[model samples]
Target chain A: MAEGLVIVGGSYAALHMAQGARENGYGEAIRLISDEPWLPYQRPPLSKGFLAGKIERDALALKGEAFYRDNGIEVLLETRVSAIDRQARTVTTAAGANLRYDGLGLALGARPRLLKIAGADLDGVFYLRSLADTLALRERLARPLSIVVIGGGFIGLEVAASLATLGHRVSVVEALERLMARVLPPVLSDFMAQMHRGRGVEVRLSAGVQEIKGDGAGRVASVLCSDGSELAADIVVAGIGVVPETGLAAAAGLACRDGILVDDAARTADPAIVAAGDCVRYPSAFTPDPCRLESVQNASDQGRAAGAALAGKPQAYRAVPWFWSDQYECKLQMAGLSPGHDRLALRGAMAGGRFSLFYFRAGRLVAVDTVNRPGEHLLGRKLLAAGASLTPEQAADESFDLKALLAA
Target chain B: MVIYQLKDGSERRVDVPAGHSVMLGAVQNDLPGIDAECGGCCACGTCHVYVDPAHYGRLPAVEAMEDDLLSGVAAGRQATSRLSCQITMTPALDGLVVRMPERQG
Candidate 1:
């Protein structure tokens, strides 16, 4: 009997799993099923280069089509998996094709949370998530027009920055008092607010969108605020956040919370099935509680772990998590989670726009956020992965060679 | 076209349109060695590459961010080290040669 491997979703995790499985000597037939028609492409550029018209659609592809064919990896594009028969170890496709597999990997990513407000379905209202959304947004950005970006997260801010760079009048309305409140400290948030404002972006914080009002022509005309204010907008982009795609997994009787529940090995409740990427909530040393990460680093690392396990390697997932966001001239790099950090030490002049914030919890270095400081970001990931100990004073001292701490 | 010399001694010459970064060129071609985990934002040092010394001086001066990132290259930094993502391809850089570092941090 010939055993086979079936992978769901077409994203970074799925590609990494296939690569990892091959590297681990999994010579069996590997089939990847994706609902999207295109090959697995990188998503980070969609918010930056793709939106800016600097990168073509073909440039976003992670691997050339020939690579998959040469590797003997079968990719069933535009095909959706309808059901998983755990008892029969088979998966039914949307076209009613039953595919048998010895192991299943779920890289089901996430979808952007849509604005459920009135006039959200208006013609000019948009959400940035898929290639289709980006292509649509790019076309809309062709002519100069007033743009209102809802939400202050990375996607919203990046879109605002790109639009402003392209000479469009941009305004950002954030519901929270500070921008990026969920991930960044108040200080960084304030700095970002100032930066955005300096770039000719009208930033309105602590303001919620009451509703997106449309003109009689079914086009977005203005955004009404909770504070009884309205801002005229030709285009309205909503980027509140994303929710993991877990409906399919839950239907198959897999353990799921906000995301599909998985162990460190990327294995779900059923050993025959494993999951990775944005859709899985897995245990991590970086966080006190199990959490779901929506970053390229998380997807690739977790997928590698799942693939290795599926190949019988069975190693635990322990890769240090890292993330980056580019807005205008600033490049912010973050390493590890800093949820419970009680103290923060600044390593450089914040006014200079080149500094690293060392986050410490109980006098131990836990995480770092670097603004245009890549050396510190890299060393920070290394130190956190190595579990190195450094006091706030040592971190604050510019004379100290942070790289030396990696050896300790 | 920009030429990239891999650590394994293989060379790849990719057609990179102007305004696109050298990292994007390698990435679009699916060339090995450049991880570019941060997607050419100059945040991740995964796209570290050594410019062929002959063409190093002809390239634009290294920016502060690229210099900072080069310091973190896992393969060890050299005077020619540059984050390929930061170097935009131009007509003058027609024969530009970049060598991939042994490893990218």
Candidate 2:
């Protein structure tokens, strides 16, 4: 019997692992098991283009059916992996099928954190994570309706911008004083708040959601804030954050922290089984601490690394992490991690609506956040990947040629 | 139809509707080379391509944002380099040729 490679989840990481396995010359059966009914698709557009009705469902697919068939990859859709038997090298599915594998790849992605307040289970309450969620939300957005978004994270802000673009009255409530407080600097956070407010989005800062009240019809009607104010809402969305899915890895006796613990090669303690994407925590030069990333760049890079390792051509995963978010007219591009940064250098004037935030720690360039400035984001990725060093003053100089630094 | 001459010298001709971008044309055809990771948002530079110099000036003028992004391509960028996603397909520009770079960053 020819041994097969079994991969779990239907997100970017799982798809990339399959591609990597093929590219690395793993010729045996390649099986991808996904809980979603559809094939792997891009998720970034779920909040922007899909929500705004600019792209259709077919455009979201990462690979067509012909690609899978031509590549000799079998896809098991709407199937869930119940357990992994490490000793036997087999995985049991929810459909009562036990499949044996020579190698196992776990790309179990994260799930959205739900709001724990009252009326959380109401009909009109939604959380955007999967295609189904986006479809339902898009249906609700067909007509102009008042929307109340809880949390000021990327997902919340993206949804707010999408709903507002659809001509809906949208309000964002952030428990923190500014938007994107955890990832972005104070100045950028303040700028984002002003940008949203300027676009007629009611950005309520330093406000906590007390409860989501439902009408007698059992649909969300209004949101009650901790400040003793009620804001009428036709729909409510909660985008607080996501919790990594690691139950299967832990149940199978794999090492796990907040996520499944993997090495630089994306391999677990059991060499036969490997994990990647948001579900796995690994150390990278980009951050001082071990971290789990939820971006597509991390997923694709780590998935390729895991696949390469499984094919006996292991390569250390050391790519600079990059992410982008589209809100209104601004395209915010970020590269590298900014943890423990001591100083920030602004490349351009913020009033000009195009600038890049260069972060440095101990006078060494660390990360960058660029708004409508793709050149800076790209250069920052290269600089961080090369582990280059530069002073804060040099980074702040407008006449400095960032591309020339890469040549040096 | 928009013609994409890949880095490996293979040719893929895709029928891109007027409103769609050349990146979407390449992506919808599953033509290898264009990643379009941001879904034609012009945020990620994965869809970098070198427009054939003959048809480069005929298309719309490169915006400041697109010019900045093209400057950041991981691979060495040429004077003909332009992000395929920012170039919209039009009937007047039929048979436009774009060559893929060695690799997109």
TM-score of chain A of each: 0.98, 0.99
Instruction: Please give the distance, in angstroms, between residue A226's alpha carbon in candidate 2 and its true position after superposition.
Output: 1.0
Positional deviation of A184 in candidate 2, in angstroms? 0.8
What tens-digit string does per-residue lDDT give for candidate 1 at B1-105?
899999899898888998878998887777889988877777888999999999999799998888888888889999898999889988999989999988885
Model 2 stretches with alpha carbons more than 4 Å out: B17-19
Report the C-alpha lDDT of model 2 over A231-253, residue by residue, as the tens digit. 99999989999999999999999
Against the native chain B, what TM-score does each candidate's chain B reach? 0.96, 0.95
RMSD of each: 1.7, 1.6
Model 1 reaches an interface RMSD of 1.5
Q: Top model by TM-score, which number?
A: 2
Task: For candidate 2, write residues B1-105 as lDDT tens digits.
Answer: 898998788898878888778887887667889887777788878899889999888888889888888877867689888899888878998999999888886
Tens-place lDDT per residue, model 1, A1-408, is 266799998998998888778778888899999999899987987888789876778668887776787778899999999999998999999899999999899999999998988889999998988888888888887789999999999999999998999899999999999999988999999999999999999999999899988888999999999999999999999999999999889999999999999999999989888899999999998888999999999999999888887777778999889988888889898998877899999999999999999999988888999999888898999999888888899899999987787765
Best by DockQ: 1
The 10 consecutive residues of candidate 1 chain A with the worst lDDT sum are A58-67
